[model samples]
Target: MVVPKHGVFTTRENKVYQMKKLLVSAIPALALSIAVGTAQAGETLDAVKAKGFVQCGVSTGLPGFSVADDKGNWGGLDVDVCKAVAAALFGDAGKVKFSPLTAKERFTALQSGEIDMLSRNTTWTLTRDSNLGLNFAGVNYYDGQGFMVSKKLGVKSAMELSGASVCIQAGTTTELNLADYFRANKMEYEPITYDTSDETVKGFEAGRCDVLTSDQSQLYALRIKLSDPNGAMVLPEVISKEPLGPVVRQGDDDWFNIVRWSLNAMLNAEELGVSSKNVDEMKGSSDPNIRRLLGLEGIKGEGLGLADEWAYNIVKQVGNYGEAFERNVGSGSPLKISRGLNALWNNGGIQYAPPIR
Candidate 1:
């Protein structure tokens, strides 16, 4: 493990006092203005390195994104991204500590520093990005809000539902979006609100609701829990743009860069044809891009406070972005989300990245 060099809190006196080291949560942050002048000292990278793990905020129980097994083994799309971050930091993907939170608690958790970063399927919006003091590092999943209705309803499209009672997760932006959509179109809806996704799915399946509304990706996961999944169909209307990305606390630039670049590195790797199974052979290849990406001859990784071969370590340990997507949600996979918007820009999608150089 690469341990960062530590620094001490500057003190002028010859002796250190520890008897009354008291901290008050209620103390006005006005006191902090006196004791501290700048944004918290070192970046989050150094702190995470010193702590030996990345505290990643994730979804509570999204199946293809962040679900644990009976033995507590975590494996999913978001989990893989966290693992990739761990690999970039410590060369070992197992060093991540996943902290799951509900939609209501997620942003608050990141703000309070309860988690180092948020790898949840959080939508990046103006309010979240600017008003809430959070930064979206990069988009990992390109998604949009959609409707899922049972085939028995015979609803071919979302526009067909004028008076349908929809089962929708209560605390998310989906609720507001649904309201606006229905109101603008002059349609009436009975919103069957639920505190959690499971409850919403249950409400839809138990004949309590004729439709369910949420992110298209989430609807795909929720569809499987139905007794007759084939009886339901997700409508083609994508109501809103949900650019899902890993978010970091606003103040730490270095930590945010590390997380952001780590995700871009994975995307770049896949675009360059670098895969986990063949990274070893490519390590000694003749391609200049490959050498630069693997940090064989470039000083790229050092900028992110990581080892020279950070990208190589991530691809070797956690696999590429496509591999992560395929393992969790793809053809022959359970969550089967299409690569429509998530595909690379070269492949007629918008998932492009800046040059590493």
Candidate 2:
């Protein structure tokens, strides 16, 4: 993999030259000229383009967001985001290599350039966005941390448990926040920490802990595997903020734009009602915005460094954000998560898209 150039923004021509040289060396001569690259700090865009795929970092086994099948094929909301970026870059959604990562390894994996971007269920906190030398493109899921307790515990409220043992994932804000909530409430509790999501759930199930604390979305996703989902209840107490989204290493404008716009494309597609089932038919509608969006007319594709028909490619290949959500977390999905803050902005939700001009 070619490492992206870093530093304060400097010369555009320098980037082009570096990308060109790298492209010439890495890819076939035919591919060099066509690649529009913004690669490593001083390297050329062509160089990264020649590599022919985006490397995405994601959770190892979150059912609604990331999971690998017995055949090792990965799919979920996060996987679909990767597919959207791939579709934008190559016009083929399959052009990607997914790297499964643990919560502890996700940031380090991105900072070292081991992966290009992370679409895992990472929350955007002040400490992470500003202090960690990373950038969160935007919040895709506005979530909050909560707890799940088995009915056997007979605890109706989070505060009712004065000495509950909790199983929380390590290397996550959830662990720290879990402590803070208990401390501030003056409740005595014991925490069982584990490095992986599965391990944490198992620890809670094995009677090692009385509660499993995590993002409400994750708790819901994990609840299905319980011996009986109805036997466990998520406490109404939501302790901390968890605004999750795609993340990229700092200082790569070209790559950053691609990831940011790829997300925007999905959001905009949903706002325009351009679902896969009807996007093509909407192409002939009189709505000018829809025309521009679906690539039926206008230069929407080229404006984002993608083909003019890029939006069409996305809906055709991976589906819109709403479809991906319903497939992964909504009523149709195993998680059965409600569209709380993730609803469309106009519909009293937070998922607003920038104008696709």
TM-score against native, each model = 0.88, 0.86
lDDT of 2: 0.82
lDDT tens digits, residues 204-297, model 1? 8898999999999999988887788899899999999889989998888888888898899889898999999999999999888889899987
lDDT of 2 by residue, 249-292 (tens): 77766767877878888889899888889987888889888888
Clashing pairs in 1: 151-231
CA-lDDT, candidates in order: 0.85, 0.82
Among all candidates shown, the one with the greatest lDDT: 1
Candidate 1's clash total is 1
Poorly placed runs, candidate 1 (over 4 Å): 1-43
